[model samples]
Target: MNLDWNFFEEHFPLAVSSLKNARSAGRLTHAFLLCSSNAEYRTAFPPLLASLAACEHPNEDFSPCGRCAVCREMAEGTFPDLITLAPSSLSRIIPIGESEDEVDSMRWFESLFYLSGMTESGWKIGIIHEADRMNEAAQNAFLKTLEEPPPKCMFILTTSHPAELLPTIRSRCQTIQLTDNRCKYSFPNSETLLPILHKLAFESKGSLLTAEDCATALIEFAETLGEEAEKTVAEKWAPRLAESENLESAGKALIEKRIKGEESCEYRRLRDLFLSMIHAYFAQLALLVSNTPAELLPNPELFEHSIRQNEAEEFGADRAFRCLAYAEDLLRAMRTNANDQLAIRAFCLKIAFK
Candidate 1:
């Protein structure tokens, strides 16, 4: 929400223009999916868009005039009209039930629609960050809001993986692909790791990438990450863990559980990061096969310099798409409690030859 106007002026003129045009035309949609991979798309962009829609006073460019009552309230984040929801501390997953309050997010959100906005502009904006974290029940409950959105109210759902969302939910909204060119993700921090990933992905004719080796590497990486996380967590909680002399069994058990949970979360986060990078590499490979311009692809310059586009072509278009699909499937599968080492190996072995 604290974005420099100059940054938008340079990188996202089209996006800003579209928002302004929709407002002027009086044809803004009730629901929108602001999709992007970068975390900013969820955290910052929605509030910016919401402020734009809710503000009545604006300059010629249609940017919100900071002096306006609505703009000031939005900036203060004390605006009753704007509702925001995200995962709570109790659970990372977004569910339908209340979040420690009497009324849950879904209930509160619904109740707001019935009431009129506090502002003169009469805009009720709801921004859901990491919206895809909503479970099936929450997503289903959200259909009611999408089905018949109230007048002068807009809901913006932001997520990195729009495909994971329900089809019905997706159909109800206008999806805007917000580019994050500012983000430059370099894979395999050390040159050593990059070659390993590439070789496992695109090793030549006779030297096919094997499932066992890929799986082994992935498992090893995951284990190393997990061990590192444990060490960090152990160091952080050393006082608590070692202060068992005065602590009761229940208190000590709780501390131990917290440490384990933190370690597990860190491990999963690391695994997810690696999987996402692999998925991105495959996506870049597909773009290369189609001869997409560097600017058009994610990680713009990284792929051009690091990945050989012709190598992807040699892998075959159908195969590339298939591998991409497999990678996605693997990522989704890993979300569950299932052991992913076998899954990773299976996917790698198939892609190695296929």
Candidate 2:
């Protein structure tokens, strides 16, 4: 949708100027990376960028005026030229599967790449909301698109974690790193997660015996985190679901599919945020021990007073770095459908005793 260029000019002046300069110079690349850890900007900037591409009357700064019909369609999610591909509701993973026959048709982005757009503004924009969520099949398919993009077509990808994406995929796009404006554990359930992390962070790390207990607690924490988020999500969507449940079996099936999708995606997203927070806790220690600026800390105020200092003194910065590595591995495994408890246990053990 149309956005206030003023916002970008104020907050993201460099990013706006880069894109605008490229467009002005007739040098816009086939694919551009918009990396931001901020969740809201991840959701807001894609459509705004698409609107810029399709704006009939872009200002000198190259942002779309919100008044045009094209801009309105984008705001309404009815813009024919601006397409979006997000993760499937059921898996919270982009089902860019092998074929249309295998994929849930509603969430497909693979074949759509091969089709021509409505040619509105002579620029077709396809936005992938979470580039990291694309499965192997989806990534492979998209790599081909990048190799030989269609005429007047552009792909804008938004991602919080760039490491999860394939190196080849990353190589094809021009990366734009957005400032990390997103706060750590900024979601509704972060308060629930932070306390559990604090408990682990400050706990005496001596023997392997307590590692199992910590592991169990971590697993429970993840479960409770997901459940708390689901409760909120379910309540938010209950009215819409209530209406759909009374429909015929076929119609009811459709609504249920949508509901399940929301549940799975929301839970997974919340679960990942918790894992990221866990990593940030360890990373925070590593940063402080390395004498990095406190301003660079993702969650500067998260670690309890004297807790991280004690942990660093006891475990040493090298081990703390290993803990961050272990946490990253655990996050990777969990994303690949690894059992939650088993992965958390492995992570806890590796961090503490490995």
Candidate 3:
């Protein structure tokens, strides 16, 4: 979890190298916009960047010394200057106001920055996680501060989708792009897992983080339902009944308990897993139509037994493309607070019947 050195060695090795050049040339930008497909890694990147900016021995190649007071404080999440802004709930949009609660949090963050900026280290760090979630009002409010940043203040905006950000805000900062790598997952016996992993990677559209999450969830789901029929049943029915009012009332009466509940993060995780699975399933169909050899296909067993059953001419590459579009739409619907169970059920049935 030593993200500072780990991130430096991994995706941002070039950024680490640029650090020395920028410092030597006195050309470091006051603000940075770090863009990446992996939202989790983008969130982790800011703290590492902050540690690098605040390092006492930044001139030394081995700096960030990990054991230093500042680094230790950062690792403990008590670093005065390192502030993160994120959505307060699953709705995934930051609230903007001068209300008591909002004011309190903002004051605490501003105080930390003010104190850190006054330190001899001469750097204060602020990270806006999920910058895409900032509403227009919130973004506009932050724009004024970004335009005239406090002296020695470094603002790092981490977003999965930079296109959603205002052009003016993006134009003011330097940009760094980070892509997740499967090799960085550190799964034991990963070499043995590479074939399936590679398939999921392609299914996730090159998002290794999404593929890894799907792989892990699929492994767990497979263990839960040992039989193929049971697995398919759960995949199909879990969503339909869970979101229906009839089932909600029946469960409440039978179990003498409430049934409507917030969608669990585990459910969202599994939805992503199923989406990836559907992608791989159709991809295999495409390969089968082209007369791909069994050993060359990612899931030859599935391809030979199930996918090939469908006529290649009837179910062509367009089927796969349509499924991808459906998955994207489901993802957007989830973000907008649609009923997760209904959205997932509809998505699954679309692919299952296709």
Candidate 3 lDDT tens digits, 290-349: 666656765554444333334554555666667667667666765665355555545544
* Candidate 2 Cα deviation (angstroms), residue 180: 2.8
Tens-digit lDDT string for candidate 1 (1-354): 345444555677787788779877767788999888755344556666777777767778677676777776665444657776655433456677764343335665567677877777788888776678788888998898799788888899988779888999999988878777455333224234445567666662234435566668766765576676677667766765677658888867755655664465445444455666767777776776777766788665445456655665676777778778877887776654366677777667767766
Ten contiguous residues minimizing lDDT sum, candidate 2: 98-107
The global Cα lDDT (0 to 1) of model 3 is 0.56
CA lDDT of every candidate: 0.67, 0.69, 0.56
**Model 2 residue 126 lDDT?**
78
lDDT of 2 by residue, 274-343 (tens): 7778878788877877766666666676664445454457656787787788878987787665478888
Best by lDDT: 2
Per-candidate TM-scores read 0.56, 0.71, 0.62
**Model 2 Cα shift for residue 201 (angstroms):** 2.5
Q: What is the lDDT of candidate 1?
A: 0.67
Give the candidate number with the greatest TM-score.
2
C-alpha lDDT of residue 316 in model 1:
70
Q: In angstroms, give how far residue 278 of model 3 lies from its true place.
A: 7.5
For candidate 1, the 10 contiguous residues with the lowest summed lDDT are 184-193
